[model samples]
Target: MKFLDQAKVYIRSGDGGAGSVSFRREKFIEMGGPDGGDGGRGGDVWAEAVDGLNTLIDYRYQQHFKAATGGHGMGRLRAGANASDIVLKVPAGTQIFEEDNETLVADLAKVGDRFRIARGGNGGFGNAHFKSSTNRAPRHANPGQPGEERWIWLRLKLIADAGLLGLPNAGKSTLLAAVSAAKPKIADYPFTTLHPQLGVVQVGNHSFVLADIPGLIAGAHEGHGLGTRFLGHVERCAVLLHLIDVTAEDPVAAYRVIRKELKAYSPELAAKPEVIAFNKTDLLSTEAIEDKLKDFKRRVRKTPLLVSGATTMGVPAAMKKLLEVIDASRRGDRPADAPGITTEEWRP
Candidate 1:
């Protein structure tokens, strides 16, 4: 199925039914009293989070949702039937917003979450309700109330344990395909992966979900080169794995560009635990790799792992390092200065 993360919908609740105005006329009875019955209540509009769905593509074709109107009342003290409610089933991690798109209405982060978006109108009173000692034999009834109507926005954010970050053709997709069962499109051109992709990575006996989003470039936070549209998928990650191509013309410049975009998008995102790695080492010889690693370490001032996604070299060490940081984060024991892992020290 095609992926869709955002949608705009229009919804309306049902209107109440009208009350009846009638009097009983029985045989051999000299006096008859008002016997008009009351109207039933209208249906409501609700939203619920369910399982087995990860996209909002279902909302692309249909955008309007309306509840059924209540039945009208009848004579001889016969009340009207109530209308059934309408429930919209959305995927987990879906957020609802008002028409302005800034004011949040609800956040369904987990399954089985529910919220009432619109309430049904109340029923009207019958003529018998107004009948009293002074006002006997009443012949009037009340009208039903109107329902509410409004437009809303729905946004989805995927949940994962770790997110892959890098520039276009930086070997992120290659790394994901090598490590997990996800078949992300891999090509030499930029932006081969248009949407976010998730994979289940098994490290040792433990497993976790890994997310791969579209590559980022300069000015990505301000709507350049796919913009920050897919960045929201990583907001729930425990750790981030930043991959930089070893064969790039300026690896240091590439690192700085990604870092700047992360900080520009969100400060909290920038503060998340990150693990940097130099990928595509298969293209370089042993001596060339050593020389490049020395210069990169000196310029960046941070130790980075060396790996080749195409040949799966030094990949196990990198996965183990990522799992370690994820475990530390989950246990709430991540240190302020977590040490970086190198392939030489932690070979798998």
Candidate 2:
């Protein structure tokens, strides 16, 4: 599995069957009436959300999907069989968009969620239905209706309780691997983690999902350096963990760069609850870390936590603080420890 979060596919529903045009001709009954049967209905095309799938790579190879057509009607007042429906299984949180790519068609958030992409055509009437007292020998039969067809776009957005946000090589992967079971590829260079990795962090009896997206850089909104492709994964998160590398030449500048990119991509994302963490504390001296913390507090008017992913220093405390923030967010209350400026109206 190559990770593919977006794809475009053409889908078509089955067409209805044609009606039969026959008359009952028996040896004893010389004057028989029409005995044509009605046609069967066509099959529908539906998209369903299922578990165990996190990507849309399957749609890349296969771009066209068509349902089975209905069977034709038969004589002797016998109806044709209905066609079988075609079901497409997609990952949860898959959003269906129209051909324009901006209009939303459906948003599948939960498992087993389904939406009908194309509707089947209705069956046609037979000659027997038109037979009446005035018109005994009817020979008219209608053809089946054509099925609907359209091209749709599928986009996946990962759902999580908390998301990690930072510039490249900001120790996000290290922090996630240290706190959760996720084993993302780590390297000293930037863009080591290509796709988003999800992990479940258990605190006592409670557990919440955390998503680690690829590092974002300046001009991310203009489709630079992986662009804002992975930013949609964090749109559903309740809280954001902002990790700033303390060893950077100017930690404040790095922090501001990421924040500018986030706000440019989506103001709502920047407005989400954020927890600031000064990572890579093991690489800096106590005096240096204290000086940087003091500068950050003066600029942001809030105290940031110092954590070392390599040495696991203050990691537990960071996890506890994240949990508390998530709990407060669930209760519709802003977290006191790390608060964000409200920029938009809360939907729910």
Candidate 3:
């Protein structure tokens, strides 16, 4: 299915039923009182978070949702039937916003979360309700109330334990496919993976979801080259795995460009725990790899893990490093000064 994260839809609640105006006209009944019946209540609009869904593509085809109107009241003191409610089943991590898109109405981070978007109008009273000793024969009946209508926005954010971030052709997809069962497109060209892909990574007996999104470049925060729109999917991740191509002539520049974009998009995202690794060591010689590692360490003062996603060299160590931070975060013991994994000589 085509991936869609955002959608705009119009929803309306059902209107209340009208009351009946009838008088008791039975045989041998002298001056019978009014026998009008009350109207039934209208239906409500609700949104629920369910399982087995990851995209908002279902809302693209249908944008409007309306509840059923209540039935009208009948004679002989019969009340109208209440209308059924309309429930929108959305995926977990879906957020509901107002028409302006800034005011958050609801944020469903987990399954079974529900929110009432629109409320049905109350039912009208019958003429018999107004009948009194002085005014026994009431001639007027109350009218139904109108339903509420409004447009809203739905935004979906993927829930993952770790996110992969890098420049285009930086082996992000290769790393994901090497570690998990996700079959993302992999090629030598840039932007081969157009959309975000999710995978399940397991270490020992523990497992966590990992997300891989389109690569970033310079000016990405300003809507250039897939923009920072997909960055929202990784905002909730416990850690980010930044994979930089070790064969790049200027690996430091490539890393800096992506880091700048992350900071520009969101400071919190930039501040998240990140595990940086030099990927694709299979394409580099031992001497060249040593020189690049030395250059990176001298410039950034941090040791970067060396890995080859194609050959799966040093991949296990990288997974273990990510799991450490993920475990700390899940245990509510996240630390700001989490250390990066130490780099070792990796050969295909």
What is the Å distance of residue 77 in model 2 from its true position?
1.6
Best by lDDT: 3
**Clash pairs of candidate 2?**
none
Model 2, range 1-348, lDDT digits (tens) per residue?
688999999999888888899899999998888999888888888888889999999999999999877777789988878899888889888888999999977878768778888878767778998998899989988888889899999999997899998998999899889888889999999999999999888877888888999999888999999999999999888889899999988888888988999899899999988888999999989999999999988887877789998888998887778889889878885546332221121110
Poorest lDDT segment (10 consecutive residues) of candidate 2: 339-348
- Number of clashing residue pairs in every model? 0, 0, 0
> Which portions of model 1 miss their true places by more than 4 Å?
332-348
Worst 10 residues of 1 by lDDT: 339-348
Q: What C-alpha lDDT does candidate 3 achieve relative to the native structure?
A: 0.89
Scored by TM-score, the top model is 2
Q: Of the candidates numbered 1 and 3, which has the greater lDDT value?
A: 3
Compared with the true structure, model 1 gives a TM-score of 0.89
Evaluate residue 102 in candidate 2 and report its C-alpha lDDT on the 0 to 100 scale. Answer: 91
Error of 2 at 114 (Å): 0.7
Model 2 alpha-carbon miss at residue 301, Å: 2.0
Cα lDDT for residue 99, model 3? 99
Give the per-residue lDDT of model 3 (tens digit) for 269-330. 99999999999999989999999999999998888999999999999999999999999988
